[model samples]
Target: MKVAIYTLGCKVNQYETQAMEQELRRRGHQVVAFEEAADVYVVNSCSVTAVSDRKSRQMLYRVRREHPQAVLALCGCYSQTHPEDVEKLDVDLIAGTGDRSGFLDLLEQAAAERRHIVALDRSFDHRTFEVLPAGGLESRTRCLLKVEDGCVNFCSYCIIPYARGPVRSLPLDKAAEQAAGLKAAGYREIVLTGIEISSWGQDLKDGKSLIDLLETVAAAAPGVRLRLGSLEPRTVTEDFCRRAAALPDLCPQFHLSLQSGCDETLRRMNRKYDTARYLQSVELLNRFFDRPAVTTDLITGFPEETEAEFEQTLAFIRACGFARMHIFPYSIRPGTPAAKMRQVPKSVKEERAHRAAAVAAELRKNYLEGCVGATYPVLFEQPKEDWFFGHAPNYAEVLVKGTDLHNEIRPVTITSTDGEFLYGTIKE
Candidate 1:
């Protein structure tokens, strides 16, 4: 069978799609491109917001309309949370967030019998983590190791907790083993990713936290660079900073989730921490690592967010001086609490997003300028035009005028920046 998968949303979704592709290939099925003809088409969808949900629906509808004869399967967050909507699409097979292997079995069955199959369990009833193989198909430079799954944090603006259930973590030993395997497979970097990586050890009851898992994986893969996914601000404590700083191979880039920087907006959003605590996380990272890149996510014009509140958020983000930021205008998710609250006007949301983006751009320029004189070990990934591109430990994209540098880590001395990429020369 020829199977093609189209993934949408976060890195976790991309990782899951890769795992599915590997499984299909392992079963002697040919995995084709989504554009090409195939026996099966999978839409690993996302529903982070209404926009995300719309995209998922559009993709599914297009696939069904284009290839009416092929078996169409739906999985991931969108289908997990809104199965009724998905069922209306007449998809051949529908699987939720869990049970990848079983989902494949149903896919095969659906293809063979040409029957509609819906295999979805109550997400909250799941207690164990569904472990899947890590690594990408063609890319050897970097791979994602999903150390945890599910989210218990029921923020007012989020529906992930309902879609993903409570926190279920991959065992420490299993994570280490996987890290070692990825290292042996010649991967230059291994990223620790999850639905909520900061909540990694909550279900284990072993008292081992994310720092412990980091230590174990670092030990297993001595030379592989270990990068982390988005973390909760509360996860960054004095002890965590100290322990994480001790890991020689850990990437010095921390992405702390800060949806809004205003206290009142944060309270309305049901965020666990305020701007002060988020700033402390940034400060702690700066204290422990030399010029560590601190990145974040911000949502503007959330429900009932006043202009003063938006200004406060801008001021707070300026104070924190993020190395990079992903700014989004607030979008309503039907099932989330924020959707029912007094909503901000769409125009206001977009305007606030634009203003926040301007501030973010300024901060990014400042951060990039600060990287002018430093030297870093850059792991080269690909070539473009006359330059080979890669990323530093701080996750700064670096370019050098060179060839044959793919998958090679070399000492690069920063010479300049065009407010976008750091241009450097490789030191022999």
Candidate 2:
């Protein structure tokens, strides 16, 4: 069977899609592009926002329309939260957030019998981690290793906790082994990803934390650069920063999840930390690492977010001066508490999003300019149009004109800035 996978949303979803493709290939099935007609079309969907939900449905309809005879399967957050919704799309096989292995089996069976199959369980009932393959689609410089799954944090605006479950971590040894495998496979960088990585060690009875797993993976794959996915602010303590800073291979970029910057808004959204604590986390990282790039996500126009509150957020963000930021206008998810709250008008949301983005743009411009005249070690990933693009240790996208620099670490002298990216030259 030839399979084409269309994946949407977070790094974790991308990791799972890659795993599914690997399984299909291992089972002697050909994995092809989604545009090409194939025996099966797997849409690993996202439900982060209404837009994501619509995109999932849109992809399902288009794929089914394009390849009328092909078997269509839908999985991930959108399908997990609403399997009935996916079933209505006339998919041949349907599974939720869990059990990728079983999903593949059912997909095979569905293809063999030409039957529709729906397999979804209560996401909250899931307690065990579903281990999937740890690498990427491209056999290249960087890969992702998902060491955790699920989120217990019931943020007022999020549907992920319901879609995914409580925290389930990959055992320390298993994480180490996966890192070793990725290193052995010639991957130069490994991004530790999950639904909520900060809650990694909560389910464990033994004394273990993300730092412990980080130490194990760092030692296991000394040659590979270790970067982390979005992290909760509470994880960056003095002790955590000190230990993590000692790891030579760990990348200095820290993506702290900051949904809102106003204290009142944070309370309304049920965020675990306030802007003060979040700033402390930012400070800790900067104090520990040399010019660590602090990045974050900010949501604008929550219910009851007054213009004054929005101003506070903009002020707070400017204070932090994030190197990169993902700013979104709050989208109401039907099942979440935020949906039923007093709504902000869409026009207000858009206005605030633009306001927040302006601050973000200014911060990004300053951050990029700050890199000028500095030297950075970049792991070259791919060469395009006579320019090689890679990332600095702080996770800044660095583009330099070079030849044959693939998978090699080279110091690049930063010469120019493009607001969000740095243009540099390989030091002779």
Question: Number of the top candidate by lDDT?
Answer: 1
Q: What TM-score fits each model?
A: 0.99, 0.98
Worst 10 residues of 2 by lDDT: 131-140
- 335-409: candidate 1 lDDT, tens digit per residue: 988999998999999999999999999999999999998899999999988999999999999999999998999
**Model 2, residue pairs in steric clash:** none
Residue-level lDDT of model 2, residues 1-428, one tens digit each, is: 99999999999999999998898889999999888879899999999988899999999989878889989899889988877677778888888999999999999999999998889888999999988888866557899999999898899999999899899999998898999999889998999999999988889868888999899999999878999998999999999999999999999899999988899999999998998999999989889988889999989899989999999999999989899899888898888899999999999999999988988999989988999999998999888686899999988889998888889999999999878789998898
Off by over 4 Å in 1: none
Against the true structure, whose TM-score is highest?
Answer: 1
Off by over 4 Å in 2: none
Q: How many residue pairs of model 1 clash at the backbone?
A: 0
State the lDDT at 170 in candidate 1: 95
Q: How much does each candidate deviate from the true structure in C-alpha RMSD?
A: 0.8, 1.1
